[model samples]
Target: MDRTQYLQQFVDETGWYNSIVLGLILPEWIWRPLPFPLQSWLRNYIGGSLLYLVSGFLWCFYIYYLKRNAYIPKDSIPSYRAMKLQIIVAMKAMPWYSALPTLSEYMVESGWSKCFSTISEVGWPMYMVYLLTYLVLCEFGIYWMHRELHDIKPLYKHLHATHHIYNKQNTLSPFAGLAFHPLDGILQAIPHVICLFVIPTHFMTHVILLFCEAIWTANIHDCIHGKVWPVMGAGYHTIHHTTYRHNYGHYTIWMDWLFGTLRDPEDNYKKGE
Candidate 1:
């Protein structure tokens, strides 16, 4: 085959780039013994939950240990009693909220996702397609839903407001990440469940996305500074929580920019001036 054809074939063969990455991280041999259905469930339940726990703990360590002495805005910090109360309330409801996604995953399976044999036969291209397609739908779904939560007065006051308690001028914390009223948490997560029924999503693809999201939620709430361009890192999300009226998009700010809600961090700095 000519060079162009060779490159095209190679790209097409491995199920796209993400499949290659998945294969390296979790080879076929690792999954061969279990049924795909079981694997899917396990990824959502055991693996995904584990990732959330680890990611949450790490962020807590960073806040309480690494950044304890770092400069934080005085106005942003909550009272010690308030912080403790928020953590207590959030921890109480977090387990149930975490399990809801697993229930949705179990029910959302369809022929669109590859079976075990199909994954081996189709190789990498399948997952790459799954990853790309799902990422778009996931982001779009969450962005709109999240923004709506803010727009609806009762919804924000009763459910989402529990989360915003941490959104003080600059006093966000890691444990504050999962500190949402159960109803509010489910509403934010509805997009993820919706995509499963509508799109052809691979099981592993679902697990990976959910895993990344667990970390992303915590990372954004911690308000530790950093940026990843189109990706909505801590800086972008921090602006969202602190201001309460802007930067509603998740995963990326492209939607925020498109929707005219994207607040520049420079603007946040200028607010002080």
Candidate 2:
């Protein structure tokens, strides 16, 4: 099977990873807070779905901040009309993020949640672990998912290539990158859902992380802060766009090195290839 098919099959048999998290062994702090009434409201027709959609779309900003002109056409780039086609594709696919609410829905359907309860009982150190793990799991997932987008040809051509249209990059490009090919966006959420099922993260941490990511990406999409990041520099990410083949890690660049996709632009990778 090809990559997508392979992942599909892997998920089919072992998909229980996500199922187990949301289905049987619920993370009390994370999953148990959703009382049936609130759960139904959030899942069926409330602010939860909107938050998911906004978060997906907001990632575009981060793409821009990493590499300011990454999406715009250089002297050698495409026309504005062409770029819109990519934008259209991304916007068109927005509705697909609705699938994410199902994790919360799972808890509601099972009557396993007890919404709004305080998480004051948990120890301080465990909370630290939760935050760290959540960050690690999230960043790792983004890196691999990004690398997969590059390694797989079919996905690259249909979904990824749309973003690569910019020979000259700029802000507003992250939105371009996120114009996923339907399957891509849904897969992004699956991991987080799984985390909720198995990992015991506090409701506040979960919400805070989600919100922080939103603000971070929104800034990333803005050109005003491309090279000068909010806290640290984005040189690692900037180089990735400059080289196109290296530095695929998001949030942090260390994971790309561990996975072996990190490349140094200074060394002509193909000088000897």
Q: Return the top candidate by TM-score.
A: 1
What TM-score does each of the candidates earn? 0.72, 0.57
Q: Model 1 off-target regions past 4 Å?
A: 1-54, 70-83, 109-118, 121-123
Score residue 39 of candidate 2 by CA lDDT. 35
lDDT of 1 by residue, 175-212 (tens): 56667897887777777767776665655556456656
lDDT of 2 by residue, 37-130 (tens): 3332333222333443466345533333344357433432334454456557655654554435445544523434322113554577867776
Q: Candidate 1 lDDT (Cα, whole model)?
A: 0.64
User: Cα deviation of 232 in candidate 2 (Å)?
Assistant: 8.8
